[model samples]
Target: MMQTVQKRRTAGFLLVISGASLWGIGGTVSQYIFEIHHLPVEWLVAVRLLLSGLLLLTISLMLGNKEKVTGIWKQKKSAGAVVIFGLFGMLAVQYTYMASIESGNAAVATLLQYLAPVFILAYLLAVRHTYWNMRDAGAVLMGLAGTFLLLTNGELAGLSVPTEAVVWGLLSGVALAFYTLYAGPLLAAWGSMNVIGWAMTVGGAAVSFLHAPWNAAWGSWTWSMAGSVIFVVIFGTMIAFWFYLESLKYLKPQETSILGCLEPLAAILASVWWLHVPFGLYQSVGTCLILGMVIYLSLPQKQRAKPAPA
Candidate 1:
């Protein structure tokens, strides 16, 4: 039994790292597609959501979640929640991250999005869901200092990244906070696969009307572009999400979330090495601080680690 449990834990660790790293690489590939091939961000978003959603739903069926696959739509409140999550939460997160990448490098974009936990903590305090504590305050301060340094290179003269990129990156962080909190109830109700599948499908369908995924004429359609898009949709979206949800079954939420730092690190490395994006000393320190905030927040307080429902 002990050996079995140990093996599961190992699997969970590997899964989290793999999933997060894939997401980081996906962002870089998306940047390449956008910058080099001039693909429309909206088109990519719409198609990615739609295709990934369908694939997830199919996986749910294969896993004997047939009941959950169809049960979500039968209720009024859940149905409503799914739709709202799809649009405002999932879609918002996806769109803003892509927009930030288009406006700036993937490293900065991803590190900024890691500010989600900071936003989540702030929201908890604002709503009186969590009480003020010194540790929480410290984490908040760390995140702020990191952001300041990252944006202005530790000097208040100006921003190292574009203003538009910063705006979209910050928005992505906010959307991620919303996504995490809003997803709790849905995951509790219908399982992660079911909830995510439906949310992505709904979000994708909504985006399709606005962006029209069928139109690829706006961008240069090369074999590389096609391959990049396929990679983003398949391995990045579907496999990454699957690994995340599966890891939850074997590891505590805190463990998986802390390990998620791998995502941004992968993005930073890929950006600098592959894309030749700048990463100066100040920015490096700032990256460490932001990542430290994520690690600190993931640590257990007075309470024990909570198991994620998924």
Candidate 2:
């Protein structure tokens, strides 16, 4: 039994790492699709959400989870929660992330999104009146300091990237926090696949109505574009979510969140290697500070205080 538990923990760690890496590299792949293929951002987002959602739902059905998928909507509260999550949390995260990547490269966009933890910590302290912990405080300071270095790069003259990218990136972080907070109860009630699948489907359908996927010019589609899209849909969105959620069975959410730091590292590496995006000295140090803080927060606290009851 002890050995089995150890194996499960190991599997969970591997799963989370693999999932985060896929998402990180997937962002780079998305950058290629946008820059090289010049695919419309709206169209790509719509199709990706829809296709990934359907694929997840199909997988759940194969695993004899069709009842969970179909039954989620039968309850009024669950259905309403799904709609809100779909329209607000899911749509917000997707749109803001794509918009950030559109204005900047994937590396900056992803790192900015990681700032969600800081935002979440702040909200918990200020709004929720949660007790302040020194570790979380340190994490917030490090995250902010790192973000400052990354954006300004010690240049007092002007911002590194366009102001537009910064705005979208910040918004992406906030939306991610919202997504994490909003999805908790739903995930408990209906499992990750069911919640995510329905949310993605609803969000994607809403975007599709506006973007009109059919209107996208098919002449632009090439082998490279096809490959990128397939990878993003399958490996990036579907498999990544699957592994990350599956890891929850063995690892605590906090551990998984810490392991997620691998995402920014993977994104930065992909940006540097594949896209040849420039990385400066100060920016590297800044990223290290942020990652270190993340690791710090990930460490087990001997007597961590319990969160206040909602």
Candidate 3:
């Protein structure tokens, strides 16, 4: 039994790492599609959401679990939170990330977006008033401070960054935090598939409106565009998310999230290899610090014991 448990945990860790790596590659891949294909950010995101959501929905139907849709809708309150999470968390984050990249560099945007875990820890402790011991608090602070060091080029004073890009990146962090927290309760009641499907559907619809897909130049679809779309749909969105959900089955949420800290590092590597972007020394140090904090945060808390009778 212990061996089986260990094997499951190891598999879960691998799944989470794989998922994070895929997600990391997304920025570089999307940037390539946009630049090479001359596609609009809104249009690209719209297509991604529509295609990915449809594929997941089809898979769910094939599995004879179409009932999750109606079941999710029946719980109107729960559905609302799911919508918020998918819209602001998923859709909005995508938008902000694209905007940040366009307005600044992928490196900066990626680092800023990774601050999501910090925001999540803070929200849990400060707003929700959750019981976070000293270690947890310290972990959060270290992670956030490291992220700051990474983004600001290791400068503690007088940082001159683009305001618009910073705003978008910060917004992405907030959305990510909200999604993580909100998904927990909603998933507990509605299950991951139902909640994720509904959330994706609603979020996709909202993005469709923003992009006005009907007005897009569909004639621009070439072999390259088709290939890019297929890659994004299959590997980036579908497979990555599947791995993420699977990992959760065997790993604790914090443990999985800590492993997710690899995402930015993966993104940096992808950017360098695929896009020929340079990774700065400051960013590398910051990435290590962020990873350290994640590990710290993921450590299991020591439990107080009851006294035994003599």
Candidate 4:
């Protein structure tokens, strides 16, 4: 039994890592679209969300999963939560993150977004009234310290970051935290595909309404743009998220969260290689520390009581 559990845990960690890696690719891809194509951030976001949502919806329908949507509206509370997740969590986070990236460097924006774990810990403690252990507290401190290092390029004294970028980055973290926290319960009630698909649909609708995608310059659409959109929808959103949900069945939430730390690192590397973004020595050191903390905090604690003989 113990061996089986360990194997499952290992598999889950791998899946989560894979998902993080795909997500990391998005930063570089989005940067390419933004810089090379000179596309407006809002318009890009609007198109990505709209197309991704439609693709997800089509898949769900083909799989005959209409029950997930129908049952969602029947339960008022769940429906409300889904709406909130779509609006405040998905939509808001994506917008803030895009804005942050546009206003500042990708590395800076990514480092700030990684603060989501801190927000998650705080939300668990305050809102859920969950007690924190020494491990949790240590992890939070380490993460924050690591974030400071990564953002300030190891020299905390010579930091000269912009205020607006910082604000947007922080907002992105908060929104992501809400999304992660809300996801577990919602997924438990409605499967991952359903929750993600519906949330994307609603969030896409919201963004479209806000940005008015119809007024954008759709005339400049090229094969590269279409390819990026296809990749984001299929690999980034659908397949990656599906893997993530499967991994959840095998690992504990904390364990999965710890593996998710790979996301920022992946993003950093992608930015460095694909976008030619340089990472200072300080940032490298800070990122290593943060990744270490995530792994430590995610380890399972041994029970005080001895196990009974088989």
- lDDT per residue (tens digit) for residues 1-310 in model 1: 9999999999999999999999999899889888998877888899999999999999999989998899888999999999999999999999999999999988999999999998998898787677777898899999999998888887678999999999999999999999999989999989998889888899889888878998768454678878999999998888999998899999999999999899999999988999998888899999999999999988887853434446
- What value does the lDDT take at residue 250 in candidate 1? 92
lDDT per residue (tens digit) for residues 1-310 in model 4: 9999889888988899898777767766776777677777777677666666667667777889888856887898999988998888778888888777777656667778877877878987785445667877888888878778776776657564566877888899899888877777997888777777778777878877667667666688899987876676677666666677678888877767777777677778888887887788877888777777767756777543433437
Model number with the top TM-score: 1
State the local distance difference test value for candidate 2: 0.87
- All-Cα superposition RMSD per candidate: 4.1, 2.4, 4.4, 5.2
Off by over 4 Å in 3: 1-7, 131-133, 155-162, 303-310
RMSD of 3: 4.4
Better candidate by lDDT, 1 or 3: 1
Compute the lDDT for candidate 3: 0.74
Ranked by lDDT, the better of candidates 1 and 4 is 1
Residue 193 displacement (Å), model 1: 1.0
**TM-score to native of every candidate shown:** 0.95, 0.94, 0.85, 0.84
* Model 4 TM-score on a 0 to 1 scale: 0.84
lDDT of 1 at 109: 92
Q: Which residue pairs overlap in candidate 4's backbone?
A: none
Clashing pairs in 3: none
What lDDT does each candidate get? 0.91, 0.87, 0.74, 0.76
Worst 10 residues of 3 by lDDT: 301-310
